[model samples]
Target: MKSESLWFIFINASLINNFVLAYFLGICPFLGVSAKMETATKMGGAVTFVMLISSMCAYGIHALLVAVNAPFLQLISYIVVIASTVQLVEMFIKKISPTLFRALGIFLPLITTNCAILGLALFQTNKGYGFIESFVYALGAGAGFTLALVLIAGLREQLEFAEVPNTVKGTALTLLIAGILSLTFMGFSGLGS
Candidate 1:
């Protein structure tokens, strides 16, 4: 397979076709864990690790399935890989820092179901990425997720100080901000062209 440049894959995945902003995958963690910068950063790191691991596993499994003519198992296999990866991350976090584990709470386990993780595996396969391409794509997706999370967390933190009318406060304001951010990310669509 002819491979695209690594830089192109990285930029396209992270900026142009962002999993959260562009594809709208993994909105749960994007909204839930992004309330604080510290939590967001940790969530991002954990996601990145899982994405990389799952991407690699998906690539290998895809090849095997194709070789054996069992492509029907793609989705199930990918989910298994992602779930196992999230479990590892959960245990590691619990052992290293109980405080962070508590803060992350259910979201850490929820990562197993985060469409973003499954999406990474599916997208890489759909794009026919090689092993290296899959790895870079995962890295880029993770970075994009982190970028969006951090930006929202920062904005939410600032919103705490802003005096706003009661009608437009709370989730209404957050959804508005998220919509604006998603539109802003749309500007990068031309980058891939």
Candidate 2:
């Protein structure tokens, strides 16, 4: 029973209720950083790392807040945890790959405010997921986010070679592709239902 629920949560988070395609969260990074496969992959990795860490921290903080009868602090606590985690990722990227870090630019720091991360924490808490469940949910969300970004990046890369019209060449084409992708993802909403 426990395993079944966990599996459902994972699948639901990663596919059915995908943060990008379904919820439309984190569109900033999705549109801005998905121009190239390499940058998209890095952004995905960073978000996954932050999501995992923030999920764990949110779980612990929620528990502590509950124990202390201060559940109202959940939002603030999650924000602090997410911000700190993003900072760590930013510093790590800066140290390891200055080039990638520069490419990421302001979008990297903007992860702190990414609705997907905040939504993940809030949703897990609302769903009353346990520690392991929360971790799996975070992982699923991260994977789903990465999958969406990579798919869009791949499409955009291919689009570079295709002859596009003057009006639909840039953002117009990107938006059209995003809409198509969202509809395609909606097809999976009924799985295991």
Off by over 4 Å in 2: 1-4
Candidate 2 RMSD to the real structure:
1.5
Compute each candidate's TM-score over C-alphas.
0.96, 0.95
lDDT of 1 by residue, 42-79 (tens): 99999999999999999999999999999999999989
Worst 10 residues of 1 by lDDT: 1-10
Structure candidate 2, residue pairs in collision: none
Per-prediction count of colliding residue pairs?
0, 0
Off by over 4 Å in 1: 1-3
Candidate 1 has a TM-score of 0.96
